[model samples]
Target: MSGVREPAGAYDPVDALLQRAHRLGADPRNTNYAGGNASAKGTATDPVTGGDVELMWVKGSGGDLGTLTAAGLAVLRLDRLRALAGTYPGVDREDEMVAAFDHCLHGKGWLPGGEGTAPSIDTAMHGLVGAPHVDHLHPDSGIALACAADGEELTRRCFGERVVWVPWRRPGFQLGLDIAAVYEAHPGAIGVVLGGHGITAWGKDSAECERNSLEIIRTAERFLAEQGRPDPFGPLVEGYGPLPAPERRERAAALAPVIRGLASADRPQVGHFTDADAVLDFLAREAHPRLAALGTSCPDHFLRTKVRPLVLDLPPDAPLDEAVARLRELHAAYREDYRAYYERHADAGSPPMRGADPAIVLVPGVGMFSFGKDKQTARVAGEFYVNAVNVMRGAEAVSSYAPIPEAEKFRIEYWELEEAKLRRMPPPKPLATRVALVTGAGSGIGRAIARRLVAEGACVVVADRDADAAEAVAAGLGGPDRALAAVVDVTDEEQIAAAFRAAVRAFGGVDLVVNNAGISVSKPLAETTAADWDTQHAIMARGSFLVSREAARVLAAQGMGGDIVYIASKNGVFAGPNNIAYGAAKADQAHQVRLLAAELGGLGVRVNGVNPDGVVRGSGIFAGGWGAQRAAVYGVPEEKLGEFYAQRTLLKREVLPEHVANAVFALTAGELSHTTGLHIPVDAGVAAAFLR
Candidate 1:
């Protein structure tokens, strides 16, 4: 079939620019979530004259290029941007340039919602260029050349006279002018390499711009290949190596809690491990100590990876306790050194900088660890450093790895424009740093409890036997960053262990676990089959036991106090007909809570239980046609069953899953800090089930 043809005059420059931005931004080797920017020149008909008017479409400040949209591209008058360049003097002119760009917006910089969007910091340079399309990216391959000691000479040899080379200048009005002048001198150049920064390419269209950028990167890769030196990590590709020994892995797991404790301040932090061959190779190098101390391959990574990673000297024979003590001492020293570096570079004009704590940590026998407020941020930082390892290795393969000088590094790290991006975020929630796991979270009380926990700012693991249901619940709570779905049969010991491991891999470690998974079978004592009894006991009794056991192990190893809550039924305490099997299993679970509380209290772990009754709405147990069947046994309509239970309660109100969730939160949130092994009745005042 022939392609459908569009009407004449249908070319869209904004769409073209967005497509290219996403293409480049999606590549981790090129740009991370918000690393790069792009711009394009286009024309629109003037409302009054019906004449073509030039417009500049630049990527908005603080927006992700991977998901660029028309709203994310700030439209400005080309003439205004060019004119704004003359308003700023040469030195420290970023603020003035920003103001001018803000004023140059199409209609007082107003967007659809009446708020204005700021253009990229490179808007001035993009406007000055003659080409219709322009892109600025921080590709690792190209950065390998830009950060090398002989970068300029190598770039010249690689591109010949096809590209311009601009010396390092902190990005602002002055740099834009410098870029324009360099381009003017080499009018035929396809792109320019900004020494110690990144690369910028331009063309008449988006495709041409992207093609030129990739070609420049490919050229750098070929030039490095011609150098004939072995990979810096030897034969290793990107510094990966074989996994560490089993004993070493165990030690790393044991040491994670100690590292997390040392790194935390007012709030706790999470720690994630990486045994990727690239990371292992970097740690194994003889010059690892000296090479690792050097600054990051690019300035954009300074905020996430820090100027330098912390290197711990851990001996193979040292005990875990001694390792913890040594780490504590070294962490204190690391902060002191960071303060010294700041003092050496601080100016009277700039605001006081926060102490530089280590984001990446290297342990020789254990591999690498990255720390963050939560798992997602930790993973992003880790990925960047992993790329940094490759870039440094690439540079060393061609020549010695030489980063920008300390003064420039300080300037970039402390730049107010870059720092503003972080300041724009709202304050974190109270439970923001905590991670939780809720079993049976695909529906009912478990799902309600998981939602409440996340709303209060905890990362959650939604575990259930139903994988699709669990995934749906996780998606509803938020994306994978906030909640992970784990298919787990809690009665299976191996599956329970694997779920905890997956939780740790997803979000560092777990601080709270809610054992809310259970099954119910209604039948007279004599009529109940052996299979029916075993099924209820398998989930309600044995499953709760296994989950609690695993939780204690992880919480104790973390060296931090945590909460484990079991969801028992009111029938556990108050005997009821036709509920013998379920009631017995729940009674076992309730007693297990008390025993666990007694044993784990010494390890700083808390164990508790919530006994809920008649919460039929949105409950999986009541669904699948079981509600009608159970209601018939009680001689009440299914619709009236909830009211029937409510009338029997002292409070005369229907109990809800949310009420049970609130009780769970109360016990786990430290409101009842001094209490443990306690069961809070959540049946809207069912006095029969009250603690005697």
Candidate 2:
């Protein structure tokens, strides 16, 4: 609560505040990502006044503390911020205070030019605290004690008056004023436990502020650890035990697509599945139904997980098909209830109901399935729920877990400030929520296609027979949220099925599939071997069919329209010499596209093909000696084969791997939605391969 004097030439307060934030945020026990704010007051030469002025730099809205940067700080003039209190509006009109923050912004070099990062709702809590440094965090341990029914009494016992208790109030200008009043009244108080929220602490210096924050978190953590009851969630209900690891994963994979379909009614959604110990323990317990319906207490927590998750009526070990059938009914009921909840509390000012679908779904024995417009959001939602579970357990250990009332939840959920934040977000890309699975994506055309899909905002499954190559492509595409590598031999049905399952688990389900795996063997009839003919057919024709079959099954399960494109070759149509086995395999692939297109039309699955000429540059097949064999037959040097092929084409252009990739993207990226069973040639106007 006390601090040392500011030394001469001390480090910038802004830099020191960021270091403090990072130190506190490094531990999950201190705060969740982007859930808290830290601030420091320092003197800066004002650009307008040309004199020293006190400026407060606080973590701006919507930034994680651990990764907080200077740009994320909202620099504000303290004198102006304090002046707003004289013109303060009542609680009902407090939302207007956010707009007023603009007048107090210290910009024109202090922050990014023009308008800077918008201030968070809790900005007043930091500015009005009358301390040189302040922190507000939502650690699970603190939230547990805050949500307890006897939180006021517990706070008194935990801190012995060093930390006071403030009653439940939704975060806003008025709540900030309330905390400032508490800080002024209790000169001995270093922090206060916010009822149904988190904790806040302040100090005379940055170091003291960080120490106070951690002490509060650690003390409450120890209080709960020692006094908390064993099995705080109560004993597991009979017949609701967790399934084996293999079975849990299998069930989650089987149901992820179905849940994704229900959740994506408004827009496409990516999913994340978790069967961690906390989730399983909570799901199997008797208290979950009561606590889950009560929902999370913290504002940041519910903003992600929603007020309540949709819990399954059937147990996890129930008959698989029956459970799935019942799940559809459960989801429908959940939507109806959510719509009613919005109607009950919404007035004219509430943001239009953002989607009635549940964000989190609990399957008793399997695990939890969370969905969002992108993979990162889904993963974060799941993580927040796990935190909620921990809070419930701890609260029940000491006292009953009581979250903020439903009306308050609705108010916060649709607050105009929150709605404004949503509106400020940029529009999604063309293929924003679409997920694509590209076979042979380890190198060549497949790699190009994978990278292209991800660039357009699609989550990609980089599938290939080469493990290292597949991993490299996936890594280049992005982090796990964007692309995941699947080592698969498409000719093997089990591995193909597993790859599709991996796609479903990683990003909900596949919406676009590229069957680009292939092999080539050019030889005259006299020299062609039976083994060569069978191998080509197995890798190209059979592999394409297997991957397509699995893709179709998932698409049907999801009831979402999807695309499958086969990367055939120009030789499929052209009667080129010494290209028997390779040409026959490509021809088989070309016909299969038509057959599947006809069959899958009713299911909203489009089937298409791309026939490309000899792609010599960066071609895995060409680099594997096919180029030398073709060059020998054409009586041209191996290095000059590309030029020779280009001269023979009407356009006289050498086809590269990217050209094949472009053709593949064209067939599936919605521009050709109405076109199917079609083969667009990537070859440079090869007259012999033109389709009638």
Candidate 3:
């Protein structure tokens, strides 16, 4: 108590303090109850017998730090400690239990004698120490270090021998005893690591305790700095060198099976890795350390194996057994090391655990591999470890980071507390998790189509001439698996091919392809240039062919029924002026959809097109306000153009992107499963002609 000081600045208001805790990632659900439980303090004799203790602010059993209520925080006792810890006295009451226990304790005169009842699980420890404030946390860094190869040694080096390190134990009462013993031995120890449990700090007041907790974490961070680390992963992909188109596709094909195998459980989704040279070069630079230092990333990921990556240097047609053997050799060593680590430190009487595997595989000239039970989980593993590699490589800048110990990791991995997170709702549907490749995604009808697919629970890969815009849209969607924005001039077959590859690599497989990319002109056919005609065909016609070609390859290979949608406009069906190039291209798309549907029907690939009427307004093909001017030129008032168009439709409403999206969804939903090569009108009833 020599360092004790007066309370500072009136505790900054409890609300302010709680907000700070949340900002620091404190689990609010575990910190506060619905009815406002503030403190945890009581004695052993009547552990639950404390009446003066107010609301029992126990961290809710399994609430996230972001959402918790005061009532959700339990109100329990401190004095009923002995009876609660005892054989439970064979009595479980519903309510007023704390009050009954308090009356008994009050009769014995050991109770604190107050109006309120109930205390927290940690009440005894909080009150016995006479500290005005206490805090506990399951910090990522601290837990990670606790599960490392040299947890105790690292702790000693980082925090000094004066710090306390308890062995892994079940939480609650057992933890309290372990802590009590440590405190008695090192009375002045300000911080405590409860092994598999968590970390704790106590101070004369709230501010001091908060400062101590943060400082302790800073100390842990310093420990991380002292340890040499590996490199972090670059973005999903890096720079693409000048590789031949065939060679790149071949490389992607080789990786397809392995990727698919990893994602097979969650459906046969595959990750297509590109920019091979960049990923290869990055790995080559770190071959020595990554191989020797094991691997990077967290412990619970051990099922995917430890940090060291599997480096593959086999031939293209190498036998599967041979490849698996090579993987086995790498994993055997990793598993052995993990076992030895546990053997050296684990108690003689702990339960056995399942062995871990190698989650990361680095193909010499290929990309990285992250294997998991599902595509989503596997990709997360792959990306996170890659990021760790970067962080480890930059350890010189941020300093080396150490992992927590294996035994501690095992305890938490199997901990009941952590297992409770599994009770939440599961993810969305797979087809609902559609993967759509949209051409000309940067602007116009293409962008609208992409947005529509995204709104329908599909992950869209937006390809456009403008790389920045594609990337912007991708970023806006959030997360790699949800959206991929790539720059590509649909006119170039190589970029088009690569764009499809990028989409597959990120989301597993492609479900829908919207050939919505096309260019338009206002010039009369007599004034059109050959170059303009060719460019239009390249994007609107040839571009559509290239994307569909790839989509067919993947869908056929997948054996799962899929859909191909082309965004053809009313120009394909009805005559329109100065639209020779666009009309011709759209007509080509329609013809191809019907022909391809015939050819690919046996393969379960349905091809269709949506012919929209007035979707041209914001399509960039028309100059600013050209739609209005066109209305006037066509002898219809500007305000009546929408009505003029809608009147022709059965729905009597202007066709929006939403209408187009709904049509696309219906086509792909297997509703039109038996229907293919059909042109669905998305322009309300525009095609229902009445010669007025």
Candidate 4:
């Protein structure tokens, strides 16, 4: 609370600078103390080894400004500096800490008594200023202001005409030159703050450097006062308890991109921290002002925090569907506001750069979330925003505050590239985009789904109880180029396990599964023996479950949800004539689909069922016996079986295996990403079972 400063009575300039750095919001925890070296006079470290003569200063590795020391700030030879700069442009480009050291020590221009050690990163600029004393520190207020929108305005207001403003650029000889140019242009200027980066100050005397630094602080304080805004955070309450590991992982992942984007878009020079809760809180509370400010440290980070953060109270593990819906609604409203703002302030030929939507979502328990192009930045932004929010909330105990307009937030949220990444990644080929494993695929419905998936750009694996049939279909479908075949008895667990393993090995992973391997019996419930019931259940109920369970394992590991489409029958959903055991097994399979959907949703896999009315395609038991009986009852000839079934439907259309295949395609294609656990009737509306 006392704030960082020199000891109560000490006149140590370094300590004083550190104190201000703390007040300005730099995290002392991340600083590097005694990490630099300096010299009063010029001399080479290896006296007899070098050829040139000049004075130099350099920073040691692993030390940042917060923890750097005067002793750690190295002073070496200028001749060496120039030699290294010429030989290794990259070294000249590195911050003075690393780049200057390599140049000053290893080159031919070593000066007499000039070598001290590695100097601070600002050493190059020190020579540019030709100053005996120089100060370089990452100030939080400066960073906070620099990372804000239109931060240039704040800089102008704070430094007035006496200071120079350099746009955000990476640190190196180039940055040093830019600072030198500005200093030379404004002869009387004593300080410069890199736009979206940090601040730099130099003076003939240490006191002068200190004076200029304090001037920056005072300028910012005055500017903030003139803005007349209260703290963005409201009354303080206990922070929500930490999120569980799974939920935390989920939230961090979801929020990382947004936070990273905000940082990149607004403040490029600033780095991100790993702490999630702290960042979340900061964004939730204080990010609006920065977003509303003119410039950020970088540009892309806007994608993470958006233009600002969204404050809301959401339960952990809240359904993703509901969460996305809420975000979409908020985004829409934000966009409307942005449109109005842009229209009101339009300048001919120059359109606004971003759209509406807060990049970061501030959930009460979760803190701030920053989004970025990469995960690291996004995670950092998220943590940064959360911490800032906490700071604002703490200040709130002393005053009231308001956030920036919602519309401004949206303009950046819908920024094009940010939105583009979210679009689903297109599959490899239009026809072989997804991978499907069709059990009983050698013929009939299984083959139909496999063929359809293949036609739609998905690779198909024709798995059947008959190896020969499987091999034939596999060959017909371009022979391992488009399809694979596996001999598998659905009722046998060992066979099912082996088939899936082979499928995964053959293909990178599975995208869709068609559990169509089933057996049927026409006996009444009363006459059906336990053995008969077991036979049907083994394939229809138990087999389907076994296959689905395995599929779930694969999907969970891939971290992308997949689809499981079961080829159920109308008998599963409704009471049909004289198929007791078959109907019961089918019913059980349908219910299992629902349960699987519920259980696997978090894992990213969706499960659903497709019920075909009647097909006369395969040579299996149902194909010959059930197909003949249905054909006879419908008064259709055997040769016209397919047509007869189609004509009898309410839609007066035949149910082709292809039609069933189409239904399977839709369910797995992500066209119906929100759908799962329900049966899709390919009977052209014959089942008429109005599901609730």
State which candidate has the highest TM-score. Answer: 2
**Which 10 consecutive residues of model 3 have the lowest summed lDDT?**
28-37
List, residue by residue over 1-692, the lDDT tens digit for candidate 4.
Answer: 11112345645433443344333234422211221122122322344553434444434333444444443435455655544445445533353344345545533322333343444344556555555445554444544455455566656766677767777665456666677678778878877766544466666545566567667655655555566355444223344444665566555445432332232333221112233544444433434334333212322233334444554444545665565556556556655754675665444533344545444545544444444332333444554454334323322322322232334333334433234434534534443335578998988777777777877766678999888989988888776646789888887787876776665444435667889887677765677799988998998899999999877766654444578988888777767666789889988988998999899888777889988777665536456476665556556777688777667678877677788888888887767888888788888767454344
Selected candidate, larger lDDT, 2 vs 3: 2
Q: Sorted by TM-score, highest first, which candidate order results?
A: 2, 1, 3, 4
True-structure RMSD, every candidate: 4.3, 2.4, 10.0, 18.5
TM, every model: 0.87, 0.97, 0.65, 0.39
Tens-digit lDDT string for candidate 1 (614-660):
78888888875657767987899998888888998998998888999
Worst 10 residues of 1 by lDDT: 1-10
**In candidate 2, which residue pairs get closer than 3 Å at backbone N, Cα or C atoms, i.e. clash?**
none
The TM-score between candidate 3 and the true structure equals: 0.65
Off by over 4 Å in 2: 1-7, 108-116
Taking all chains together, the TM-score of candidate 2 against the true structure is 0.97
Model 3, span 149-253: residue lDDT tens? 455665676677545777655444445555666766776777676543346676554566667667666677565656635333222222222334565455655
> Could you tell me how far off, in angstroms, the CA of residue 535 lies in candidate 2 after the best superposition?
0.8
Which candidate number has the best lDDT?
A: 2
User: Pairs clashing in candidate 1?
Assistant: 239-277, 239-278, 240-277, 240-278, 241-277
Alpha carbon lDDT of residue 505, candidate 2? 86
Candidate 4 segments whose C-alpha is farther than 4 A from its true place: 1-433, 617-622, 631-644, 687-692
Best first by lDDT, ranked: 2, 1, 4, 3
C-alpha lDDT (0 to 100) for residue 239 of candidate 1: 25
